[model samples]
Target: MLNYIWSAIVLLSVVCSIFLGKGENLSAAIVDSGAQTVQLLLTLAGVITLWSGIMKIAEESGLTAIFAKIFSPLLRPLFPNLDKESDAFGSITMNITANLLGLGNTATPLGLKAMHELNELNGSSDTASDEMIVFVVMNTASLQLLPTMLGSLRQTYGSNAPFEILVPVWLSSACALSVALMIAVGLNKRKRRL
Candidate 1:
């Protein structure tokens, strides 16, 4: 569906450019944008590789375990029914850790693993459990301590202070996470009453 939409957009652009007698300009813009996109991808790839390696080191050195321990207190209430020693909970912690460091690509697999484990704990039911719903909400409202991807993009585009968005990111993520949790909890209670 997205591919079809993009193809239609490109087709329209070409038709419009021909009618406007700007075909050469359109061609030049397309070539320039393609080159720019490749350059941006390379830059982002390097940043992601560097951060992924750092996260691997942190994991091997037990840094992630320490982080999980620290975060457990805060995450406990959100997933009250989950056992601390369960694989689902552990995966959830690791996923959150990856997101906090702004390693979203790395976090993806962990999030999926967490969800799978959560589903197993739910007895592989068709319906999502409260914990599962809350976990999804939490992941969506990911709180990043370092917005590495955004910073990389900013730097790639020539920003002097790429990480200057830290405070605003924190404020927004905190508000989002807070509100999402409240809503998830409220809905769960309401559903139970029905």
Candidate 2:
């Protein structure tokens, strides 16, 4: 569906240029766009490679374990039923860390593992547990402390200050995560009362 939409957009642009008597200019733009695309991809590749390597180092050096320990107290309230020593706890910590860095690609596998662990804790129940719901909301909210992906995109597109949006991103993400948590908690309380 998206491929069709993109194709239509490209075709429309070319047709419109011809109708506007800008067909000759369109040829130059098309050539320029290809070069720009290559440059952008190269820039993005370097940034992604650096982040991936950093994540691997953090994992190997037990930095994530230390982080998990530090964040466990907060996790207790958010996931009351999760066993501290369980695989779910570890997977959840790693997933959150990945999200915090805005590394969605790295987060995906960790999120999947966390879901698997959550299912295990649910005692094979068909429905999701409260903790699982919270986890999903948190993932969706995605409160990024360091939005590397966005920064990289900005840099690729030739922004002068790529990471200047960090504060705004944090502010918005915090608000979103807070709202989601409130709604999830309210629903859970109402469910329990029923």
Candidate 3:
């Protein structure tokens, strides 16, 4: 569906450019945009790689274990079904930790691992469990403490103060996470009652 939508958008853009007598300009822009996209990807890849290494080191050094311990109290109630020592819980902790440090690219694999672990715990059920829905909501509206990815992008684009958006990022993410959790929990409770 998304592929079709993108194809339609590209087709529309090409048609508009031809009608507006800007085909050459559009072609030039497309080439330039591709180069820019590659440059941006390389820059982000460097940042993400650095952070991923740090996260791995943290894991090896038992820092992530400490993080899991710290987060356990807060997460326990939210994920009551997940055992504290389970692989799913560990992946969730790592994913949440990566997100808090603004390592979104780094968190992707962790989130996937967590979801897979959750699915296994769910008896390989076709329907998503309450815990799975809550976990998804948490990830979707993850609160970032550092916004490192955004900062890296801003820096790459020549921003003088890349981290200046910290307060707004915190406020917005916190609000989103809060609302998402509330809705997910409410729905889960409603499902339980039914």
Best by TM-score: 3
Tens digits of per-residue lDDT for model 1, 52-140: 78776876887767777888899898888998777788788888988887778878778999999999999999999999999999899
lDDT of 3 by residue, 49-89 (tens): 89889888987887867888889999999998788888788
Relative to the unseen true structure, what is the Cα RMSD of model 3? 1.1
Give residue 192's lDDT in candidate 3 (0 to 100). Answer: 93
Ordered by lDDT, highest first, the candidates read 3, 1, 2
Could you say which candidate leads in lDDT?
3
Q: Quickly count the clashes in candidate 1.
A: 0
Predict model 3's lDDT versus the native: 0.92
Clashing pairs in 3: none
The C-alpha stretches of model 2 lying farther than 4 A from their native spots are 1-45
**lDDT score at residue 83, model 1, on the 0-100 scale:** 87
TM-score: model 3 vs. ground truth: 0.96
The whole-model lDDT of each prediction reads 0.88, 0.86, 0.92
What is the TM-score of each predicted model, taking all chains together? 0.88, 0.77, 0.96
